[model samples]
Target: MKTNKIIVGLFYLPMFGLLSCNPQEETTPQYKTIQQAIFASGHMEQEDEYIISATADGTIREFSIREGDYISKGQLLVRIDSDVSNTQLQEARVVYNDAKQNSSANAPQLEQIKSQIDQSKTQLNLDKINYQRYADLRKKNSVSQLEYEKAELQYKASQSSLQVLEKSYKQAQDALQLNADRSLQQVKTQQAILNDYSIQADKDGIVLEVLKKKGELVRKGEVIAKIGSGKNILKLFIAEDDIAKLSIGQEAIVQMNNYPDTTFTASITKILPAFDEAAQSFTVEAAFVNPPQLLLSGTQLQANIKQQGTKKVLVIPSAAVIRGKYVELKNGEEKEIKIGQKSGNWVEVKQGLTEKDIILLPKGKSKEEGVAKPGGE
Candidate 1:
């Protein structure tokens, strides 16, 4: 038994030494299959907001609303101090009245002038008879030729005076007629000017902002206030590349910054015809069908629009897929992948990896010289 033990010890001692010298090999950096959440982050915005501006130039006499005030359609937003204008209007009215009273302005005033002419004619007839009697006396030599000439001249002077009076009366009547016509036009012009005293809202909405202070001067046709159509909509901006995937009536999930947990239901409402030149994105308008109770104008929001067409897809963290199809594999292998339908967070994986294989997701690129590998971290 002692000899057998000795032989067993000798056999095991070398094996132990060999095993002690050889440590377990460190695990090599390897690519891993990790589920990564693809994310597209943006904020929420209110779709329906109206901005108001000033219309007519004058000091604001009264302002009916402030920021965040609810107002109705045709509500008087602001009033300008139109005291001077009103006074002018009143003066215009007086002038108009005076013009109306001017009898010469009316054709009937011509009758008054005609009556004066008839009276003058009667005086001329009497003077002519007197002149004729004087002329007969001069023929009997009781009156001299010089006296006859003087009487004839006096009668002719009366006739000329009547004609001149009639002409003057006709001119006065014509002037009165012109004055009446002018008065009527003046009244309308004054009314139109007076109407500018008050500024009214064009639509039903809350006041988002008050641009002008009370008593601020403004010009005609200048925009004073803005109103948003009460559509209760949300404006969402989808990237130009992703806009093609969005269509009208497409479902979307809306979230506001103020309310984090709640998700308001919404759908694509309109796609803008023109793209913003500065922002390389399409303007997509969405309607919140069942809007949240806390919703208000100018509320910021975040949107996630899901693209249609569901095919089996391999999705990785968007950070894992960089510069098109290239992604880091679980084996620390950076390889190109075939990509398909892409939406907000998930994209369809057409090629390069299978369901059986796991893809590595990189948190992000490091500023270090070494390439980002699956097991390098």
Candidate 2:
């Protein structure tokens, strides 16, 4: 009986130790400010960074600006070798000038046509005088009817020849004028093509990069340099599942890897509608309200876009809420609870649970295990 009592005491001692080590975690909901946000990772970029490309294929004769140089709009940035284009332009000008000279009112061909017209007019007047004489002579019986008829036929032939000369002159003038107009258009087109060889800045910006050095060959449409507007902005890529929570004008908190201890505030300026297949995410852009004193382009950053602002609401540790729609009560029973916005490690209770009710953490679960959901389920 003594040994049996001792064995019974040991068993009870182990049981008591087990009961003492495990305890139910419970907490009452309290009202506090909660912020709901969506997280994204991205990098810093200039507000307007454009890649400048060559408009014409040529060797880089000279580069006026270097990297990190500030330039104004319409400033000449590069000079491409324009020997070929210049030669072509000169040839076009010669052709245009020749065409103009040929089409001029004083051209040799027009002068010859005018001379022929004057001669034809003089001959027609002489024939008309002879025809009038023959008519008078025939009426007076001084000349035969056949002689009068011959004079009349000669006069008509002179008139027809004069008309043909006048028409030919007009046709020659029109043909020369048409040729001159076509040559003028060709000259203008060549001039435009020549102008493209000298690259100029399209906007006021700083030269961020120069892809080709002097004397390097650049093809038409090839990127030659990069320019920045000198204003820093954040570019983010949010996952497809979380893109719905973002909107223009929403505020965001930005943190850079370089500035680990500091966080900057910004506002959503743009949300791109297209998805990037390479990134498997949607693009977003933000502008800083008060930017940091030292910021560089291409700096990587992480951002939290504020979807819901801070508000005083009943909240509990996220671990207390289970399966998103239910919560464990202090009385060891699971009850359905309506949830609202969530941020960080806390969740806002919208219905089914009140501040007066006590919430129990799941068995063997700690507060740290409750991860905040981006968008509350």
Summarize candidate 2's per-residue lDDT along 164-225 as a digit string, tens digits: 99999999999999999999999999899988998888899888888998999999999999
Instruction: Give the TM-score comparing model 1 with the true structure, all chains together.
Output: 0.54
**Each model's Cα RMSD:** 14.5, 12.3
Model 1 per-residue lDDT at 317: 38
Q: Per-residue alpha-carbon lDDT of model 1 for 15-112, expressed as tens digits?
A: 66576653211111122233221112344344455555554567778987887777777888888878888988899888877777776434466677
Best of the candidates, lDDT:
2
What residue runs in model 1 are displaced by over 4 Å at the alpha carbon?
Answer: 1-51, 103-112, 117-175, 215-224, 278-280, 309-377
